[model samples]
Target chain A: MKRLREVFLSALMLENPLMRLMIGLCSALAISTRVESTLFMGMAATFVLVCSNTIISLSRKVIPDEVRIPVFIVVIASFVTIVDLVMRAYFPPIYARLGVWIPLIVVNCIILGRAEAFASKNDVLASVADGLGMGGGYTIVLLIMGTFRELVGTGKIVMFERTLVSLGSTFQPPTIVVLFPGAFFTFGFLMAILNKLENRWWGK
Target chain B: MMEAARTYLLLFFGAAIVYNILLIRFIGLCPFFGVSKSIETSIGMSVAVLFVMTVATSACWLLWGLVLQPLGVGEFLYIPSFILVIAALVQFEEMFIRKVSPPLYKAMGIYLPLITTNCAVLAVAVESVKPGFLKLNIPYHYSLPEAVVYAIGVACGFAVAIVMFAAIRERIELAPIAKSLRGAPIGFITAGLMSLAFMGFAGLFKL
Candidate 1:
């Protein structure tokens, strides 16, 4: 139990896939313009990561070393396909919004990186814990960026066509916050903050 | 003839500049940051991407039109099949290059495997077959010629962005900077500024 907790916590903070490891940023930046879309994207990615990590952990011994990358890709791709079809069927609007990013998840380094670095070497339970932790870390960063971007870009937060938080008409939004560069700026500042916190706490 | 040439040019620039695969569209950013630390490696990555993207996109285009679409499994099968195609193509290209031309392989060999997981290659492959995702001003479905042109343009755009960013990053390395934002954070901020510059090209040519 203690070991699993360590694995999980490390992924969440010490070795975040986005902030520290820097493995997956393509989809994170592209879809983080809106809180709703970021939430869904994070969920879809976490689902794929957990499932793929478990399967890869289970079959780690059987997969030959020479062909492991291909095998890992095949496993990850299958799960991404499952997520894609289900989303397209149930949520057409999101499916349309996410567009190519859904399929692009197949190549996301977070899943494959976890598979190669952690899952293949660890037990199933540990792998699952790591997946959740990494996914949570990725999602948290996405949410932070999403909320900031949406609020400042549009001056409010709307989910399901309802306004959740409105700064009112007096608050003029900076439209750039919702654009492509805003993604970089948000991620950069947030990453810097995380680094500052880590340094302050650990003295490293 | 002139009209067709103009259309092709529009598709090319539309993918390359206005919607750059790296700085603008946010695809294949892993390499954009990973390999852009040095101009040499970034150039190597650029060549590998250019070669593989065009070939991979063409191959996937053929597979979609020839097999998947005919069988009506394209809707669901595309994700898996396209990924497998890319993975296999990268391996095969690596071997083919080694056996056929040693010197050529030496230049691009290191980056070949890396391209498999690069989202830009896969994104280009999928977008070429399934249009409308990119929202380009071109037509709905891409013919072979158009797809090739677009892929080349995207690869070139990627090359331009990474190489340019690499040069900037090289200079950035020497600049005095905050310890926390020294590496990736500063990279992202610099990329953001560059992206802001690219945004200036949004409506150019009105393609």
Candidate 2:
């Protein structure tokens, strides 16, 4: 239980994936263009990561050394495909918005990198903790990015599918927030803010 | 055929310039972020990726268009087939480049192998396999050489972006910046800025 708390907490701030490791910025930058898509993408990635990490850790000892990477990849790829098909079927709107990013998860580097770096070496439970932590970290970053982009770019907080979490009815969302450059500028501001807080607290 | 060829060229160039599979489109970024620390290495890895992408695209195209598309398995076979083809092509390219281009092999180092996992190549494979994927003025019909050309052009565009950014970055290292944003922080900013600059060429060319 304590380990789980540590895992979630670490992923939240102490070892944030984007700001600290810089492992998976590709999807971070691209999918963060919209709030709904970012949340969907983040949750999907977290699901894949958690499952794959558990499976990899479980099979680590039995898997032969020669085919280890191949095994990990097959596991990861299967999950990605699973997510892709499921999204295409149920979340067609999101599936379309995500487009190549859905498939791009296979090469996310974070998933594969984690499978090899952590899962393959760690125990099942610890790997689960790590996966949960990392995925949580990833999701947190995405949510933050998504919230910023959505609020500033369009000036409306469209959450999930139907809910309009807009600040005020009169508020018109900044259209630039939905565009490409908005993703960057928003990310820059967030990064600056995160850095300032981190430095103030952590003394970086 | 000419129009079709031009379309592939358009996709190839489009993915490179406008969409930019690397910095902009967010594909093939592992290499872009990992190996692009130095200009010489970025050029080498870009060439390596360019070669592998061109070959892998054609190989997967044949596999999909001829084998999968006819059997109606084209839709579902993308991820599996692409992963297989890219992995195989990366291996074969690694061996071939090591043999024929020793100096090049030495420069790229391990990134040559990592290209198999690069999302950019995977993106090319996925896009090339899509039903009615358009290039420029022509309606894209999946063919052998066309796939290869499109892949090469896209990779070249990536090569253009990374190589250019890499050169700038190398020079920028000498420029004065605040202490907080020196290395990696500035690198990310630089990538963001370069991507912004690439936006200016949005409607420059049709293909």
Best by lDDT: 1
For the candidates in turn, chain A alone yields TM-scores of 0.98, 0.89
Model 1 pairs whose backbones collide: none
What shift in Å separates residue A98 of candidate 2 from its native position after superposition? Answer: 0.7
TM-score of chain A of 2: 0.89
lDDT of 1 by residue, B30-77 (tens): 889887878887887888789889989999999999999999999888
Quote the B-chain TM-score, candidate 1: 0.91
Candidate 2 predicts chain B with a TM-score of 0.85
Native contact fraction of candidate 1? 0.87
Q: Which stretches of candidate 2 lie over 4 Å from their true place?
A: A160-163, A167-177, B1-9, B100-103, B132-141, B205-207
Q: Per-residue CA lDDT of candidate 2, range B1-207, in tens?
A: 898767766766676677776656766655676777788889888777777788778878778877887998666667876887788778888899889989888888877877867888887877776753334334456566666767877888888978887888888879997655666666766777777788787878854
For candidate 2, write residues A128-152 as lDDT tens digits.
8888788888888888888877776
> Candidate 1 regions off by >4 Å?
B96-111, B137-139
Best by TM-score: 1
Instruction: Give the per-residue lDDT digits (tens) of candidate 1, residues A1-204.
Output: 999999999999889899888888999999999999999999999999999999999999999999999899889989998998899899989888889899988999999989999999999999999999999999999999899999999999999789999999999999999999999999999989988988999999
